[model samples]
Target chain A: MNDLAFRLRDARATLSAVAVFVALFALYTLNHPAGFSANVVQTAANKGVLLAFVAVGQTFVVLTAGIDLSVGAVFILANCLASVVVTGSPGAVALGVAAVLGTGLACGLANGALVVYGRLQPIVATIASGAIYFGLALALRPEPGGDVDSTLADAVTGQLAFGVPASAVVLLAVMLLVWVPFRRSLIGRAVYAVGSAEASAYLSGLPIRRARLLAYASAGLFSAMGGLMLAFFTYSGEASASNASTYTLDSIAAIVIGGVSLFGGAGSAVGAVFGALIFRTINDLLFVFDLDPLWQPLFLGLVLLGAVSLGSARLLRLKNRLELFGS
Target chain B: MTVPTTPVAPAPASPPMSAPARRRFDPAVATAFGCIVALLLLGSLYSTRFLSPDYLLQQLQVGSFLALVATGLMVVVLLGQIDLSVPWIVTVGGMMATAAAGHGPLGAALAIPFGVLCGVAFGLFNGLGVAYLRVPSMIFTLGVDAVAQGLMVLKTGGSAPQDMATPLMRDLATGRALGPVPNAVWVWLLVGTATSFLLSRTTYGRAVYAVGNREAAAYLSGVRTRRVTLAAFALSGGLSALSGALLAGYSGKAYQGMGDGYLLPAIAAVVLGGTSILGGRGTYLGTTAGVILITLLQSILSVVQMPDAGRQVIYGAVILAMLLLYGRGAKIGA
Candidate 1:
């Protein structure tokens, strides 16, 4: 029994979601034999890819027991800037992708500067940065239209072997890339340490500010990656409306549901990937069912509420068991 | 943790506290004085309408609502937790008021308490979640916001409610006393004064600061830790509800996102007014000053015809600067 639990994933919050995904996928296959076909798989992969990236970014911030509430704005800002530079030309497309990522790094750097050197709390610091970024995105585009090279779009949204989706493969690659630093690097350990206890970390003289700066910056870099995928999904960028605003909450929800504590410390890259996959699974299932847009938020909220409640319940049961045996 | 001055943390803690918290008064007064004087100069220099009595009164009028909501948000921040659900709570409060008004003013007046009670109910919910469940306040409040938004959507059907407040309800928002001042201003004074008194002169206030400083220590010292947390959230929720009702009474038409704009400013005002974002080191008086400073700044910027986008940047920057200025104590709880 213990071995089975060991074999299972660590982030317990996501289990029920995984089960739900399985159920939904089962339901979809039953309802439509074609739903499990290649086209649907690609569509689902393409749709969830950007959000998965954003959730990945959110994971980094959340690991430090902080939230990047500005992820949506950061995503929008990057894509919108990229839209300005990238049109029909392939060179323009390459340049645009670079611009989008650079935009994300710059925004992340600004957040890092305020949070580290400026001595601001992560929550307020991000909210303020988010506000500024939103304004900048608005000022840059004022309207919601941008050009993307069709070829570039095709490349990103294309596929790999065994009918595996391109977006899915890229997402996996990104996850693998991020895990390298998080699992093996000094910065990774520092992140968990700071998130666990800032005071203790400070006492340990672990360059706490630098660690936090890197965490926030890396989170921003992922936001850029998410934005690139997001632009490709629609093949456009626009700042006229609160574009991708939903992803802010969605990304955080994914992180939380992935079994990361909001209080920071104790999470895994696998957990975040699973979390994003779970969230996207729901969206994909909903699309398969042809549910109305209004239901999306309500459903998302309910699923998240269930996942978090399950976590609390599990902890409570564990405490009760310990108490019973101890007595 | 190098201090720019003599390192004070190493000193025995009890002795420094009673060196008269009053001794720290001069800088505060000077800062408030400087802010006021700067506003006056800017107002006079920038526009022909600045010194006009009507313009000043109009700005004061608008500031009153923000002041009321910020006052409520300040109460919770005092306890080292935040209330992200405030805007929607106010919206719901307004909705409840309008719903109650179908019967009469007596009915609408009854709704005021109900609105406040609803807020308290949510606050208690927040307190329980944060204190007992050991969940982060940020996620919990964000959830509360979603639930409240859901409730509003269910109640109003994605549009402003058809109901308006009864006459008595409207009077609280719009009713004026003596000259140009509105009734909301009077209510603000009442709430601000009462809160200031409670925070300064009451045992509950001290307990709040104690818990905020360190919950475990406060719990060990025999404070009813759970009750204190609940009361803090309850007060925040109730105040937000009252302000919401006051808003509904004044505006007569409650829209969905009206409370949205108040969220950031409410937090910003408390921080700007020299309250630590981390709790146990701020006063209602400072928050009150912050409310004034922020409202004045917004009004001034608008009067100067700054673009809406530019104003957001300036607002964010100013708030960031203020947080850096006075934030002290242990890091704030999530």
Candidate 2:
């Protein structure tokens, strides 16, 4: 009973995020012109999964009480690289995937090395690295053009049997294969420990630096996965500054809505996936209602602000105001 | 695993020298000056025209916009909080000023102040969220930024805004004054003077540094930390708005995304000035040097016709180098 209770407590944020996502999704489908069809679901899933992968990658870093502002740039970089390479035969496509993932790992490692070894702040370090990554992307694809293997892209992005979305399944598989094992491992626990209290984690002999480095590496890997997905979806690569920035901002929002604390040491990738889905639903809702797309940012902004305010509501109950500064 | 230590000069002056006075004469300021001199020499290698008084003054004029934004950023950062809403607040100021000026004579008269007032209001909202509600400043300010962008978009119907700047604004921003100096430089000097005075002479400034150094401790010492945070954010907002308005005037029109370029550079300038990103240490003089350096760098990059990618790469690399250099001994995070 005690174990179950602790588990529930641990998953509280994720559960809340799930509830919010379900509610938003229901409203979206009810109002969607197509009305809960598999087609709508697939389209939404495909879009949401892009951000989901990025947000999940972000979760790894945020869990360690740090942030990776370069995820979007890395995503764009991987997309550009994949567009150039993820063509030809199956063997060639496989190699291309490996190369793209490797590039992402290198980027993440660079960010980790700067933060952990060079002793720069994560925010500033990532901002700098993000620019570098975007620069590389721009150099690779100054203008959007290139191709992915159509067969591979179709297989991955296409619908599965029973009218299910393949992308949603991929997201689940990723969670099971990557996130579950990470969450169960000692190193994963170290990531959480470091995020919760870096000094305490260090004093307790946790390998904080290694955990942090791994977190960043995984972030890079996942964002690269997102990039590959983007290549598959778009059938080409474009090094778009606006898209990169939007993804970066949206990933943060998704993480927040997904119940992952920005301060770290808590939350799950599952929550983040749900957050991304909810965010996507907002776009669908806007579309279905036929409102001017101009109002989208405003509506989204209000929701984001509301969600953030809700998260901070606990502060009002604090007896001592000084505690506010510490958190 | 070697920790870098900042080597402090060992009591070179007399014992009677005050600690604040000593800090005011930080070696960072000296380094900033050194960097300006070195960069200028580098610029001269490109052409003698780079060293011309007219060219240097032109660069200073261009840099003033960044310097103004950095002034406000320095205040909020000094309190260990950041304002990411700077971009849209700048837009709001510029757009509002331009729209108002289009309304006729009275509107033209109120245009600049009107834009600045919008910034102050937005800043207050940011302050309320971070200070009163205790939202983390980063996320809160970002949310505010999104809302501001949305509002601006809605106001302009997602196209380029229609209004242009008043002649007065254009003159203030781009006109020549005192013979050779650009009017923008004069405006920057005014903002700089007020900022320096606020940081050095006022009790509130002392409160800001103290709160930034350690907010909980400052509260314990009876400082109203919340009020200090609110004021800092408000000042930051107002300044960002003022800068935006100036930018609009300089460009001769207000548009949808005029504020985008200033956000990162403003933060970069503040941090480059040796003001701790983590807060509680820095000087406006250093920020001034930082603004000048960044502006000159931009001019040089443009002169060399470096592609956008190359420029971004250099910018990011330089920022990382600066962070490593300045923050070698600074302890960051909660």
Interface RMSD of each: 4.9, 2.2
**Could you give candidate 2's per-residue lDDT for residues B103-199 as a string of tens digits?**
7799999999999999999999999999988887888898999999999999999455557999988998999957889999999999899889989
Give candidate 1's chain B TM-score. 0.87
- Kindly give the stretch of ten consecutive residues in candidate 2 chain A with the minimal lDDT sum: A318-327
Error of 1 at A32 (Å): 6.2
Docking class of 2: medium
Pick by DockQ: which candidate is best? 2
In the range A162-202, model 1's lDDT, one tens digit per residue, is: 67889988888877777675767887888888889977887
